[model samples]
Target: MASPDTRTQLLDAAERLFAERGYRGTSVRAITDLAGANLAAVAYHFGSKAELLAAVARRVIEPINAAQCAGLDRLLARTPDPPVAELVAAFVGPMYDEMRAGDEGGARTSRLIVTILSDPAEEVRSWTGPAEDAVRDRYLEAFTRALPDLPPQELWFRIRGILAVTAVDRVEVHNRLAGLPPVAGEAAKQWAITFLAAAMSAPPTGT
Candidate 1:
């Protein structure tokens, strides 16, 4: 039986390791050792290394998802229909805020997201570690609403672009973009919102 604190400690270590080495690169012993915990703690808290990796990924992704969902709820509560811009912004704002706040190694998470976007594993790509299929479905409904006139494929493209822009990798890129200064996560979030707003608003070509 692991102590409650041991669980947190193990997760903290696992998050760092997973972010640093990726899923295959990190080892259970490494995580346990880093946490100053025993192997039993790892198994007790999370059944297997795969699960632990997923758990680590969840630690980073879950909060962002919650924030996004909450933001969406707020918009929906105010109006069943918001302007496309606010809808896009709401979809992305919590992420920006999280990155800006820079806790939970968000900068790293941002970079990780870039990797995921370009080439995600079977698991990570399955929408934030497999808990809420409905969330993505819900977001898609919001997206479809925002771009009512666009074809489904076009809307999906725009959504992909928005996801790409908001990716943690972009945050890293944002570091190098001149005139942007070395801002953090929130800046990335805001820029993504602005860019997405434009993309969402752009007139659809005859398609």
Candidate 2:
């Protein structure tokens, strides 16, 4: 059996390289090389490259999902019917917190999310799986309760937009809009929450 430390190193290396090179683009030898383990270490610890990718997805996504669920739990405990802004905040605050962390882990996570969101490959997206769906359903259910007036489809659209804004656009904007004045951490986070809340609360235009 590979030592626990080797397993951790492989995970860390895989995450970084996967974020940079993408799942299909990264190779087992490259992962092991970065991790300082033999090429067989991935097979020993994770069985295959697909399994390693899944493990990396779980490593980054589970914590964010757990934090979002916990935030929603706290909100629902106090206010069974939260305002859209509060609901949006509860759902997205953990993500922004991670983005604002200013560390290697945070950057890796941000890149991983962007990679997952933008990668057209079905397999790349499938890594999140039922865990992602379960958390998403919980939030959508909460939003439905909060805004029964809106059509369920509309609410889903807004929720997806909220996620895209927070997960993908936020990072892309920073890189692409370097010429623009930087929004400070707290201010930028609040801007996202406020913008998303407004979008969620908007009356659907009869099309």
Best by TM-score: 2
Tens-digit lDDT track for model 1 on 21-111?
6666778889999999887877887787767766666666777788778888888999887788988887777666655444443666666
> Worst 10-residue stretch by lDDT in candidate 1?
124-133
Task: Please report, in order, the local distance difference test score of every candidate based on alpha carbons.
Answer: 0.71, 0.80
Q: How far is candidate 2 from the true structure (C-alpha RMSD, Å)?
A: 2.6
Candidate 2 residue lDDT tens string, 1-207 = 456599999988998898877787899999999999999999989998888888988877787888898888898899888888898998878886754443443555677778877878776767766767888898898899888888888887888898888776446446675887544566767888988888888887667
Model 2 TM-score (2 dp):
0.87
Q: Local error of candidate 1 at 140, Å?
A: 1.9
Error of 1 at 16 (Å): 1.1
CA shift of 28, model 1, Å: 2.1
Off by over 4 Å in 1: 1-4, 99-105, 114-131, 170-182
RMSD values, in order shown:
3.2, 2.6
